[model samples]
Target: MYTLYIANKNYSSWSLRPWIMMRELELLFEEKLMPFGNGSNWDSFRKFAPAGKVPCLHDGESVMWDSLAIIEYLADRHRGVWPEDAKAKIWARCAAAEMHSGFTNLRSTCPMHVGLRIRLKAISPELQAELDRLNELWCEGLNRFGGPFLAGEKFTAVDAFFAPVVFRIQTYGLSMNTQASAYVKRMLALPTMQQWQTEALREKWREQGHEKAVLAAGDVLEDKRMQP
Candidate 1:
């Protein structure tokens, strides 16, 4: 069985990537949650994560550390990590890669905090540009591949990669094109996403770093998590 080491579901956006994908695919694996700054042993995480990061996957002897790497590893061993169609697969990879490497503005200005709803202090020009880009890309994929998912009919790795963004969008109420907004609603309504958020709300350990970053970005309108 694969052993997936993650961190707090409330703030660990990277961790959420592989976890939600694995859960949606019904892949069996043991979860190791190493929450940030709450007795999170870097040495223990680095033992498998190598970079002291979450979302590390240990598949027997093979240790995969980065979220994107974990997804690719699953794609190699599993059948449905990506789309079945060749064109869809390629587009999905590109979209996932784009999400991984780009969108620094959105990633920084609006970090994923599933437990809180915040009215952002400001959306800088850079962040607005990135948000516009997000709408454009999502619309393109939805238009190109038909309805339901980024690549095609099924929810593949591409959708999983953007799962955190769904929460980020919710936390900030970031606007998007109508179709893209509908896509966000569909993703948010998923049973697995609901499960993740529910679990995230149940976490009592609050990381000050995440909290500080959040308040620095905006005013917290609501906090659904149980207090630490």
Candidate 2:
């Protein structure tokens, strides 16, 4: 059996990637949730993760860390983790890789907290540029490969890569074009996404640093999901 180690669902965007991928693919694996905060969790995490990060996969004797690397490893073992067509596969890989590497401004300015609904006081010029680029990338993939998902009608690793972005947009009430908005709705409505959000809302341990930054930027919006 495979074992997947992850951090807090509400704040660890990196951990969500392989998680949603495995869940959506209906793969069976044991989940080890390690909430981040102090020295003890860090020490435990380091034993399984060489980089001292969450979302590490333990497949028997072999341990694989890094979200993208874990996804690729699962893809090799399972079908539909990525698109099947060669051309579509290439396009999906490019978009996923781009997401894996770029978009620092958005990631930094608007950290994802699935349990909170926040309204940013201001969207910085750099952040807006990143959002614009993200919209273009989404549109390009949707139009190029045909709609309903990033690469096609079926969900792929590209979609999993961008899943955290959808959460970021919804949680912070960020704006997007019509197509992008529709896509976000579809992503959020996914059963796996819903499951993650529900689990996140139930988490009691809040990352004090993230909460402080978000509260300073804007007020937390009232929502039923925010209620315990």
Candidate 3:
């Protein structure tokens, strides 16, 4: 059995990537939740992950850190984690790579918080530019693939990679284009997504200094499609 070391499911966006992929693939594993930055055994996580980060994967003796690397590793070991078509594979790789490298502004500004929401004081000009670029990326993916997912009919690694971004867009109360909004809706409808949301709602750990920024009192939107 594989062992996945993750932070609180509520705020760990990177953690979600592999967890969702594993759930979607139906891979059985044990999950160890370590609250981010501080907790009872926070320092011990570094022994498992070189970078002292959560979302570390332990497969027997081998250890893989970083979300995208984990996804690629899993796909290498478990073939269908990503789509198999030649073109779909290429575009999926591109989408994942772009997400892995870009979006600094969005990430820095709108961190992922499961039970929290924060309205931005000012959507930075750079962040707005990044949003435009993301809109273009989503539009391109939708135009090429048509309906449902980024790479057309199937939800590939590309979708998994962008999944957190969808959450961030909503969490920060960010605006979206038609394609982006549609994609967010589709992601919200995933059973795995609803499962995560439900679990997050039940978690009680709260990181002190980060709480105000992460979870805003007024940002709770209407309960839409997530499973409870």
Candidate 4:
């Protein structure tokens, strides 16, 4: 079985993808939790990954870093990580890439933290524009694909790619159109996602200042609070 090295379950968004994908695909793998923040954890993570990142997959002797690479590698080993339809496959790739490479403001402003909650304020106008574009993307994908997910029916890698975004959206209680809200609901309903969240909720590990994002969701952020 493949071995996955990951950071804290509560805050590591990248760690969630392939970890959950493996479960959804029903592929058995060994899970090693390296929980971030300790010097030793960084040392171990860097030893396995040249980039010193979490969610590193050890396939026998070969190690792969980055969530998308891990997902693609597993998809190669087992099908159904991506869509079966050719056209849908292309769009799925596009959506995944867009999610992987873009969304700077959303990521920077809203770090993923599972259990804690806080209020936020004074979001940048630029970030608000980014959020608007993201809403449009979510709306279009749901409309075209007829989704409870981004690519419609099945929970493909595309969904995994944006799962972190889903958490961010929910945590922030970001305003979304009907379609986007429905898509968020679909993602939340996934068994694998529930498992991830359950694990996250039970985590004792904490990151300084990340609690605010989680708390922000349930509470109202003042108009002046912003992450600098």
Best by TM-score: 1
lDDT of 1 by residue, 1-228 (tens): 999999889999999999999998999999988778754567777767788888899988889989999999999988989999898888899999999999999999998899999999989999999999999888888888896999888889999999999999999989888998999999999999999999999999877888888999999999999886
**Candidate 3, residue 117: how far the Cα is off, in Å:** 3.2
Q: Sort by TM-score, best first: what order? A: 1, 2, 3, 4
Residue 48 deviation, candidate 4, in Å?
2.4
Whole-model Cα lDDT of every candidate shown, in order:
0.91, 0.90, 0.80, 0.77
Assess candidate 3 and give its TM-score to the true structure.
Answer: 0.88
Off by over 4 Å in 3: 39-42, 212-228
Q: Candidate 3's C-alpha lDDT?
A: 0.80
Cα lDDT of model 3 by residue, 73-127, tens digit: 8988987777777877788889889998989888777777766555677777999
lDDT of 2: 0.90
* Full-model lDDT, candidate 4: 0.77
Worst 10 residues of 3 by lDDT: 217-226
lDDT of 2 by residue, 1-228 (tens): 899999999888999999999999888899999888843566777988998889899999999999999999998899999999898899999999999999998888888788778888889999999999999999998998897999998999999999999999998899999999999999999999999999988887767776776687677885434543
Q: Judging by lDDT against the true structure, name the best candidate.
A: 1
User: Would you list the clashing residue pairs of candidate 1?
Assistant: none
Q: List the residue pairs that clash in candidate 2.
A: none
Reference-based TM-score of each model: 0.96, 0.95, 0.88, 0.87
Error of 4 at 20 (Å): 1.7
- Which parts of model 4 have CA positions greater than 4 angstroms off? 38-41, 209-228
Off by over 4 Å in 1: 38-41
